[model samples]
Target: MLRPQGAASKKVSVPPALKSSRGVKSWKEAAAWLRARGIEDIECITPDLAGVARGKMMPSSKFTSNTSLALPSALYRHTISGDYPDETESFRYEARDSDLKLEPDLSTLSVVPWETDPTAQVICDVVDTDGESVPYAPRNVLKNIVALYAERGWKPVVAPEIEFYLVAMNDDPDYPLRPPKGRSGRSILGGQSYSIAGINEFDELIDDIYHFSEKQGLEIDTLIHEEGPAQLEINLRHGDPVALADQVFLFKRTIREAALKHGIYATFMAKPMQRQPGSAMHIHQSVIDEATGKNIFSNADGTPSQEFFHFIGGMQKYVPSSLVMLAPYVNSYRRLTPDMACPVNNAWGYDNRTTAFRVPLSDPQARRVENRLPSSDANPYLALASSLAAGYLGIKKEIEPTEPTAETANEGSIDLPRGLLEAVALLEGEPDFLEVFGKEFIGIYAGVKRGEFETFMQVISPWEREFLLLNV
Candidate 1:
């Protein structure tokens, strides 16, 4: 899978070709306007549980005042391969191939910078012909999660810290050993991670990324050369979980598009390199009451709040099950190797890095739990939704987490599944992940993940090529 690497130092504004077309304040007017921009085509995109966009593009001339498109009602019912069965099997057993009405979500319209023709992008909601949200839509899944929180006068604020790398591929397999741009030597092209002095080596690449990102409104929170050679992480401010997920989807493409425009490649593989700290999307989560705007996790008498404990307890209680959604991809399991700043166990500690979850030493008013197990390969939508679901379970059951331990490494952290199969089993066995994410999502998700696992199983890797070619 192609993954993004490096923090876009900033997000650029919609380019000139896109400047006049901000949020589609009016889809009808915007559609008409786009039709006049010499646009020969428009593509409607729907993101799947895997965070991959899938949908059809249509000729611009045919779009009229009341244009409506039909997508597979089962579109919400499949894996990334477009490989789901009909009514005889799976989630939409009753619905079959019914059309899901496509209505434009105007804010999502943007210029497809890489497209050859005059093309614009639009994201749509999956609705039945009756115009109701598809029950299994990933977007709707988050909408439902948000509504659940709203009912309790709470808001779940989530922040995503993304890590990616810059790479260059060459025709000769050994050529990749050189710096991507051919600038290799005693120079620190891809040396030690975040060495303050060595950090200057890649300033040009980092500078261009930040500039491009600034113009795109990514609202970048922070950027740092992380603890990996040529690896970096970008932080975004806390936002509503649904929007945060969408941002992550767009953010992935933004970095990729920008990096390519600058002659570099970005990757988000959880453990791209063997001996370094793996990329992680550690989530710092907390809840605030919508009415008072006061953080419910804040302790009134100057101690850790009970509400806070319940939330962490909720997350910790079902983490093993949540791992299926939290770390969905096969490469995700590789990062669970002990002591790589990637977690092997499910332990939470105060200001500690070894634990699976952690409480930062930052101000108490800003206190939050850091979920450290999720790999860089995790999908933002599924990861966030599953987490909310598990945390809610924690609140409902009022579970208390065992105290954080002083043991180093994986001594006391909860064990994570070693592969996609185990992760799927974890999801299936735990009622929290199953019920919250729903059986349909579980089925589709497991199906796609299993497909990926199978693909990996069939392919022989370089190590195997060398180690077992003759022996096996």
Candidate 2:
């Protein structure tokens, strides 16, 4: 699918109509707010397919007047390793790698507390030369899914619990990561498992995280020490899916920044250490009637509504095909092993962590489902989009679900993809997935993921050398 090289193109203007409607006035107001804060640099960030922040830093003076900036449209298609598949067509080089407009979401403006300089950041969307959203952009993909709910007068509320690890700083990838020494001058031992003292060991770092989160306007609800050493989990307050996704995107960056300031490394890698539980971005979701402002998952009599069952049915029907979006990387599958309390099958249950879909204990109004399959490395935007879309499809089609499992789902027989390659194959021709996430988008995404998998397989792992090299 390689295209012949073409001449370089200059600026691509935002469509005049879109510029007027999509937060143009808000951007100017943001510019004024930055000036008032004496912000010198503005980091304009767009989320790539991998949810990594990719963009340029510009002087505040330029950002104030220009409400729009341009970047290569192909930026969204890059793999985690910064390589591209030869067959990619979403942002072809034949288009001369043309500039796509970046329109800032002024509401995402936040002070960069970690930046020593007076700097701020604003999230932006990649807009085509036609001024419409690029369909494949992660943020735009999520917005489209959210719009589907809006059309039905229903809204999806999401709360994300992201688990991560804090390890000692090391430059060598081959070296094993270990928990860093906290303020008490002792490294964390294994199996903290919600110990209050375990969290207090890193009080200084955790406190700084809260302070930074406040400055950034992140509404973090709770922080707890997880099962693994130096592993921590933070829950973001629930709200609109799009807004929650934005918070997750920014929260990851902020935590890393805070960890660096404290001379430790915080990682969201799916499986950072062997024999340790992997990090996951468990998403808790609920639907509400936009007009009545009441939950749609529960009836007035405090009983589970048909919509709730259908939503679960939708998840069971579509989640197998949607695994590529939730568990995107090779390392992601390593975390899905059975008995780790991570999901190994497409099972639904009440208050059961082993099941992929969990209906947590809550009052009638607070009722919701939690998707436990997403790794921390997964893109929050894509993860949320796939989940909300699946639930919506269930509601629309009224799909019936299997009986909820009363025990561990891993003990049951329902099978899901066991690896990234298998996950890609499952997603390859899924009509339900293709209908929700366009064909072009899935094609580009799958190609990139498969390319990454091939790249990973080429590497000789330490385990292979240690065990198989001599034994085999």
Candidate 3:
């Protein structure tokens, strides 16, 4: 029989600053916080590997108690299809369902604006019974990566530009999605590039989005109509990497819920429509010296530092191998086609959108690198973690970048893995990636994706019947 191993579990420690000002470390503090907000229920949420919020709902009293929330440890092992892989030690149904503790991150407390009742929600970190973080948990993966930066007295500041599509609600996966009709009684055909009227077309829904985001403390900066029909983008204010990730997770959920209320569907599927441009969760990243609280990538005189080039070099070297994390599914690869806004390779350039990494036009304090490879569907936590880890390694090694590109990267200028399997193969070959992300996580992630790939191959695509069957 499988057994729960509590003896090896370590206690979870909350940072002093968090405990004092932001996080609730004791039940008494949690009770006070809930009582002050008049919150009757608490929604305990954990972001899975895919950044899907999964957890339990409980009364505020229970949430404020010493009792730890227990959920199946296998929650981390599910494939994108939401099914367990075959007969693995960690994922098999035959294995006794082990429980992991879900501790609420008090800093994430916010009222659920859509809920009629006085309900609040908090994000959680999955940990072992003894309180050690689950190694395979996506949030923990990011936490470990952040710790690596902290060791070198560096802190990663990140902001995410999240893009998605608002479509008519559809239940069938086989059916194509369509843009929802706006207030003008028509759906956009094409070319809404930052048009103010386009935003007003969906102002009702956008108003709700802003309302919910404000209530939930999302710190959303801008809302714009993107390049494609019904495409939308929301930018979150930059801060700590972990905090920013939490905001992204919550923001995505908030958008979906708000869309539903307005009788529409909000999707972050990278390539939802073949004719429209793909959605991406581009991350803007910069590092600060922990002790000095200054941007490390630039000098006091506002000149680029050697650390900046190494950071860029790190991204160029590691992004190829880390594509599995940036674009996890088969559909994600479709978004990386040439000539699209999305870059096909890990090329870096200044103010050039065609490159995978872009040095945005900003002053010394605000200088940052934008990683444009990650699809909006990619897990925000994992994507940010992978990018930061690579850049940190580059700084550690003092890697140098190539000359910055002055023009758009030409067609076929950079080679990239063409498929999910190819990306997985590259990841497996990159020892540094495997070592940095952890063998346990890499194994589970690759195996689950491989299983998903096999499932996908078993199906006959529509193209087969439309052309191949009659031709053959």
Candidate 4:
């Protein structure tokens, strides 16, 4: 079945990239850069939520193979339940049950600019042996949602502002785990928000991340030092919905990899510390109709107030049930308290940050609603999908949101259950969403998340022992 060495077979143009499918770099030019730099261990990585690799590591010899390889189902930080439906208990993977293949989405291939030695990484899409997408994969979920918008002659653009902290990576037997301080106490630089000099002082590391992102072909919108100390967020420009989701996935992976290479562990955990600002993945949303090239979220009357209010109403109506999607973890709800400006109530205001739903009323054409309930840890695809599902429900029903007062989201509860079970219970109580997103999906999501809660609860926490050891 092989063509002769010089068969003169016709060639097809596959753009300038993917012409040859063998190597860390999609282009021969990139491969040359690697050979010159003595780069090896061309790692093929898939990001899992629990911080594990679900793909294979390529040996230096076979780095130039022209065929794709198969891997177990990929992973991410938010699969709150069981492993991929088929993974066996043996290796925590069952290749036999796997109908999935890791197709190299060559567009994501990049050289790790931060490492001293040359290293290249590529993002792969998880596909079945029949070449169909695996439905449960996070990437596939986002891809499907994005496709829905395209099918409807509309495009949804998203930009997630990530927030997180940096803590010690080294072991200290005497000291508990905490962020490294001025030299020891886990304290961070104070009162320097938006200061150019502060950013300049750490220019080396900041610039490194920028360059790394650039090498990966991520559109760097802007990088800034957020309000909280040691809190940094890199902003990527919005693109096509599917591509934007890919970019977000890649962005998170790149940050994690680059930080680890520097021996500083970075966390995307919703709340790593009690006193600090919990990490949030606040999504700024807007939609455009492809046929007329007009933004659907914009009000044609040159006043977006009405459009903004409708979107706000959509969020307010579905947020209670949508909590399962937005805040998927126990730690996620810790950020929902009023003290953190976490939008404890489901109120919307013109250009306000205090409510769960905020209409950023800047320019009429550019106005959009900011959904603030999601944590940095929630799956962007499912969160966005749930939001879109809810928004569509709002539009269909011509929703008029109830007034937001003390009872909007129940401001009285001292300690709201952050557990997935409770969140799923609220979601189940709302039947309004079933007619749109379907009862099957809601049931599946609820079942999965609840299973995760059971699995997590089975494990004994060190905190339990610290207080109980002496007393017992």
Best by lDDT: 2
> If both were scored by lDDT, which would come out higher, candidate 2 or candidate 3?
2
lDDT of 4 by residue, 261-313 (tens): 65676677787666667778777777777787666776677665444456667
lDDT of 3 by residue, 352-434 (tens): 99888999999998889999999999999999998998898788878888899878774665567889999988877788865
- Candidate 1 lDDT over residue span 1-472, tens digit each: 4346864556765434345543556646565557556677777777777777777788765543557888765555555445553332332433366677777677766656556688766777777778787756777777777778888999988898888876664356433332354234332444456565544555666665666555334567877778776777888898888777777777787777766765767777787766766788888888888888877778776577788888888877788776977787777887788766676877778878888778888666677888887776777877788777777778868889888766675755347778889887777677665556677766666666666666667666788878898998
The per-model lDDT (C-alpha) reads 0.71, 0.87, 0.85, 0.63
Better of 1 and 4 by lDDT: 1
RMSD (CA, Å), each prediction = 8.6, 11.1, 9.8, 7.9
Clashes of 1: 24
Q: Which digits, one per residue and each the tens of the lDDT, describe model 2 over residues 45-150?
A: 9898999998889999888876568888677656799887676554243257788888888777778888989998889888888998888889999999989889
The lDDT of model 4 is 0.63
Name the runs in model 1 displaced over 4 angstroms.
1-25, 28-42, 58-64, 73-95, 111-119, 170-179, 182-191, 195-204, 407-409, 412-414
What's the TM-score of each model vs. the native?
Answer: 0.84, 0.92, 0.92, 0.77
Compute the lDDT of residue 123 as modeled in candidate 3.
90
* Ranking of candidates on TM-score, top first: 2, 3, 1, 4
* Model 2, global lDDT: 0.87
| Range of the 10 consecutive residues with the lowest summed lDDT in candidate 1 | 174-183
